[model samples]
Structure formats: C-alpha cells, structure tokens
Target: MRAELPLAAVLLTVVACQSPTAEATAGPSGVVTWAASADRMGDGIAGRSYRLVVHTSVGGTDLRIRLSNAFGDRPITFDSVYAGIQQEGAELRPGSNRRLAFGGERTVTVPAGSTVWSDPLPGRLPAATDLVVSLHSPDAGGPASGHWMALQQSYATQGDHTAEESGAAWTVPTGSWFYLDAVSVHVPAGTGAVAALGDSITDGWQSTTDLNRRWPDYLARRLQRADTAVKGVANEGIAGNKVLADNPAQSALNRLERDVLSQPGVGTVFLFQGVNDIKAHTGVTAEDLIDGYREIVERVHTAGKCVVGATVGPFKGWHEWDPAAEAVRQEVNAFIRTSGAFDAVTDFDRILRSPYDPARMLPALDGGDHIHPNDKGMQAMADAVDLTALDCDTIG
Candidate 1:
C-alpha cells in the first residue's frame, strides 16, 4: 500500500547513506610527533631499502609518515613502505609491523621538489618509542633528499626487503636518514607542536650518537610528561646552517616554510640560530641578521603561529672567532633579549656562557670545540624552556 519513490530520490538517499563523516572526509587530524629537516645527499642510491629508526614525542593512534623529495632533480619512486616498532638493530617487534599505502596504493611516485604523506595505520604508538620505518625505492637517483646528520643509526639493504622483520638483509649501517622526513600521530584535538629552527647546536652535532641527547630531544621528553597541550616537537636544525646565507645547508630563512610552517599541528616556531652568520665573517651586520629574523617572524605570524627566540650561545674558542664577530654576537644577543619582536625568549647565551668570562662558553658544557654543547648542556637548554610559553595561541 506504500507509494513508490522516484529513481532520483532513491539514488540521492543511497548516496547520502554512503557518505563518510565530516572528520573522515577532512583527512586524519594528526600532529607531527617527530621530524628531521631534509638536506641534499652527496649521491643518490638506487634500488635500496632503508630501515629508519625515529623517536616519537607524543602517543596517539593513527600513525602516518612523510617522505620528502625536496632536493631531488628527478622523480623518485617508492615501491613499498612499512612501519613497526624496533626490537633491536634492524629487527622489528613481531606482530607490530604494518604496511603503509598512499592513495590506497602500495607504490607512489613523488615528483621532484614535492612530498607525500602516507595513509594512516591504525594502532596506538606510545610516546618515546623507537618507531622503525622501512621503505624501498625502485629508482632513487639525482640529488638525494635526507637528513645528513641524523645522530642515529639506521640500516639499509640492496633490494626490495621492506617487509622483512629480521636484520639479516639490512647489512649496511647508515648515520643519515634517507627519504623520510616527518612522522605524525592523531592526538587530542587541542594538542599542538613546536618546531626548533636553528643550526648545528640544535642539530645535535656534538651530542652523543644514537642517544637522543639533543636539546630538542630533551625538550620533547619534557613535553611528553608535562600537563601542557603542546606535546609534539620537530627538530628543524641543520648543521652549519646560517640565518642569512647558505653554507653547507640551506639558510634558516630560506627553508622556514618547508621545515617549520609546513609541518602539521605546529603552534610555535622556536628560533635558535645565527651563530654561523656572526662567525662566518661574511660582513653580515646585526641589522642584516635582525632583518632576516624579523622576516621569519613576520612570515610565521602570517601563518598564525607564535615565535620563541633563543639567544646565540657564546663561541670564543672556535677557530673562526674574532673581536669583530664577538662584537656582532653581542649586538645580536642584545636585540634578541630586548626586541619585543618575539612572543617569548630563551637566553641560551646566558645558559651556556661561562660566568667567569662572558665571551667564552662554560667549559663543562662545551663539546671540546666550544661551539656546540655537550649532552649535559643540551639538557640544560631544554630545562630552560618554559613549557607554558609554548602553549600560546596568539601570534606575535
């Protein structure tokens, strides 16, 4: 006795029933828990598999990975990718390995100067866990994209062995992280992250290898246990990087968008750079460096994020130090301390400088070269950060 519905009405009803939720259609709402700024590798390797081990800062479900081809002059094809918990050297925890796909496909071709994020793997990734990502590239050539100074030991193999859980095939030990750049996890809706944009000190140059002793790493550990909503951290530092010019790596100003602003769920850009610019003797004045910093702060503010400035640490014992450079360093630190240009400031110079001689670094913290901080110094820098300042929602 019921009347028949029109075909159009029936089709519309079916479509509505099959539609995904608003959140699902919008993509995974995840925050980056770990990231390593990418740099150009000396030479690219083809037909190789990489077992990259990275530490997570926050715990959450729905894990995702980011692969970068930023410096590649040609397209790179990744045939297979997997993620798992590390049991030991090149070995994965049993029953924890899961395959990752891009757009529902196992293989994805990333165009030159582009990046791709994988579909989320459903599972809870604990904070501070060693997450191992295995990826195989069928053809990876041209300028290789990776973090050259990982300060961690990752493994590699010659063929398509990404799904293997054992270490038998992964014979080559690599200090650099290849292709992979960022890792994300779905945390509570309000959780955010901070990106440390800096140089060798921030990049863990003198920090012990495979120990996660970098200042940023220590900061991440603190964030994990704290009650603050800012629970994620990304280390965007590059060894020998400068604020105004490119030395061995891209300048902080030039790579700001690619390394800091582009990261997911980042709420603050922690600027801890400029030592190289002052010591390089490149005729870069405090005005020039300040202009560069202002530009970065403006750009990040435009993107709706806060900026936390860190004073440049003292480096009087390095071979490049001179009176002119020391004068410039002092002038720049003065501005960083009183500029009101940043939302917050951390006086790393005060933290690492010797009380006896303000121009020199504390002997206990100096990592032999007097330029980079030792592991204890790294921890001190992290401890100096006010966690509440990182949770600011207003841009400055």
Candidate 2:
C-alpha cells in the first residue's frame, strides 16, 4: 500500500512518470500515417460498437491509435478496442485482429475535452492498406465527438462486438467515424508527416466513397514513390468549415493544436481554407482573411513546423457567389501567391480554375457542385504539390 499525496503533487508525479516514456517512443523515428479531425457528433448513442476502416499512408511497425472526446460534456468509457487489417466489408483478415491497451489497462475513460493514446501494438502495418479499428463504448452520450463526414463506409453495431473478426456482427453502415481520430506507427528514422488543414475539398467531399481518392490520399501515393522523407499524411478537413469562425466545425485556428500539431512526426501544415469565410457574406475582408493566414503561419512556425499555403480556388457559380465576395477571393489569392509569409505555396487556383473563364472551376474537373473538385481535380491538386516542399527538415 502507498500513501496518498496532494492532488497537485499527484498530477505532477503522473506527468513526470509519463514524459520519459513518451519521449523515448517518439524519438526521431515514429510518425502518424493517418488521421481524421474530431468534430462534435450530432447525436449520441449508447451501447454501440464501431468498426472504422481507414487507409494508411506509410508502412511501419508498432501501430497505435488515438481516441478523442474533445467535444463531450461528460466522460466516455471505452471498454474494448481492437485494430486489424480489413479483408472486405466489415470483415477483418484472419489472425490480424489485436487488442489494444491504454496505460497498461484494457479499458480507458477519456474525460471531456481530452484524448488518450493506446499503447503501441507490436506488428507491421503496410502503406495504403485498409486498416480497421473496432471499438465499443459501454456508455456514450451527450455531445459525442467524431468526424461527421468520413467519405468512406464503416460499420457499426449494438453491444460488445469489437473482439469479433467477422462482418456478421457489424450490420449498420455509417458515414462518420466515432471517437478514434488518429493512427500512427514507428517508421524509418528519417520519415516524417504532413497535415492537410482545410475545408471540404481537402476532406474529399464529392469524391468516390471507399476509394481513397482524396487529394491527401493521392499525395500519400506520390510520397511513397518519390525520393522524399515525408511519408505520412494526415487529412484534417471538415465540410463547411471556416478558418476564422466555427459553425459546421470548430474554426481551423481553434483546433490546430489537436488536429495538426499534436500528431507525432508532423513536419509541415498544408493550409487550404478561406473560401467558406469569404462566401458566407460575413463581412470578412481580404485583410481579415490574410491576417488569419498569417496567424496560422506564425503559430505553426513557433511549433517548429513548416507552412504550405494554397490559394483559394474559384467558386463563381456557387449559390453564395457575388461580386463583392469574388473581389475578396481575388485579393486573398493574390496574397497567397505573392506573400512570402508561408514557407511554401501551392497555386491551386491556377491548377483548378478554367482557362476560359478564369473565375470558375474547370468543367471536366468540377464535381457538378462547381465548389468541390471531382476525382480528376483532386488528383490534379495532389500532383501540383512539390513533393520536396513537404520534406523540409530544418523545421519542427
């Protein structure tokens, strides 16, 4: 038996005990290969199981998972969780499923506005593989936390079915991923990662589901084949999200720490937001938007990471289009193209804009919405990213 200490002393002791091990495991070699931004869930369900299928960007050993309750008003308890390779619809490959522990315990209770990482599972995870995370919450309710739009098909069911490897128990299909937000692995010493911080375009909206056609997904493929050391990719985009304000999701600035910087081995932040802020007719000026971008760049730089800024794409035909908003867009794009504040810049407006109109998306690449990009446009955006820009080693 041990004697109890004051709460503050106890907290300090816990931190002291955890820091050394964290520093060791994160030693210059580990990287987060995949991530999904956690947003406030619309509704909460009790006693349910979820098997989320996510595509990996880089292969490595000692795979780990991060569970978030960032928006919950109460603590959430996860009794069981498993990680494995996806064989087919909700089915895991034979002998691939493995149980995960939290702080040496099988169960973990995440407090509101907090996250917890599972102890690393020893094994090899291949790049581009469909990795599935199965989780069961004994009591999950009140402002649930998750990504609202996954752009992929994941399965859910009632009760404690997380330990099952077959698809039979997971009968309900879900478009959103619950609780689990990130997966990481131990890569070669020189490997690193990039976090794409943007809106629906970066979120793969309108792209084919279950195909891994997001621009970040394409970028991952490019990194794998290129001669660069930046091999990990984390897509942190939300549909209808804004850079300066919160609505569909928290503002990019507000969530940057949790969504971008906190991931292991992140070397750069890819900023590709602002269209929503300009089009909302919220009286946001070009200067206001530029200031937001500058803040993001400064904050990222302070964290020892590089910033890659992309010019806002044209949206002349969208419902909210107007001359005033178009003027703001042009001004913002000019700054993004000419401003040396960003460590690197990608001219997405130049790559996706129609040559004939110069103010609209190319017809062939438009996803019919004129605002979001089709698969071709998504691929084109990824292609335009200079693989070298993502491999900056001098920054954090």
User: Which residue runs of candidate 2 sit more than 4 Å off their true CA positions?
Assistant: 1-29, 394-396
- lDDT of candidate 2 over 1-396, digit per residue (tens): 464321112111111123323532353247998899999986567898999999999988777788888999998889999888888999988777778877666777888888888776766777888999999998899998899799999999999888888999999999999998998988878889999999999999988998999999999999999889899999999999999999879999999999998899999999999999999998999999999999999999999889999999988899999889989999999999887888888999999999999889999999998899999999999999988888777532
lDDT of each: 0.87, 0.87
Residue-wise C-alpha lDDT for candidate 1, range 1-396, written one tens digit per residue: 454331112211111122122222343468989999999996677898999999889888778788898999998989999888889989988766778877666777888887887776766788888999999998888999999899999999899888888888999999999999999888888999999999889999999999999999999999988988999999999999999897777888889988898888999999999999999898999999999999999998999899999999999999999999999999999999998999999999999999999999999999999899999999999999988889766433
TM-score of each predicted structure versus truth: 0.93, 0.93
What is the alpha-carbon lDDT of model 2 when measured against the actual structure? 0.87
Candidate of highest lDDT: 2
Q: After superposition, how far is residue 16 of candidate 2 from its true place, in Å?
A: 16
List ranges where model 1 is wrong by over 4 Å: 1-28, 394-396
Q: Name the lDDT value of residue 387 in candidate 1.
A: 88
> Over all chains combined, what TM-score does candidate 1 have?
0.93
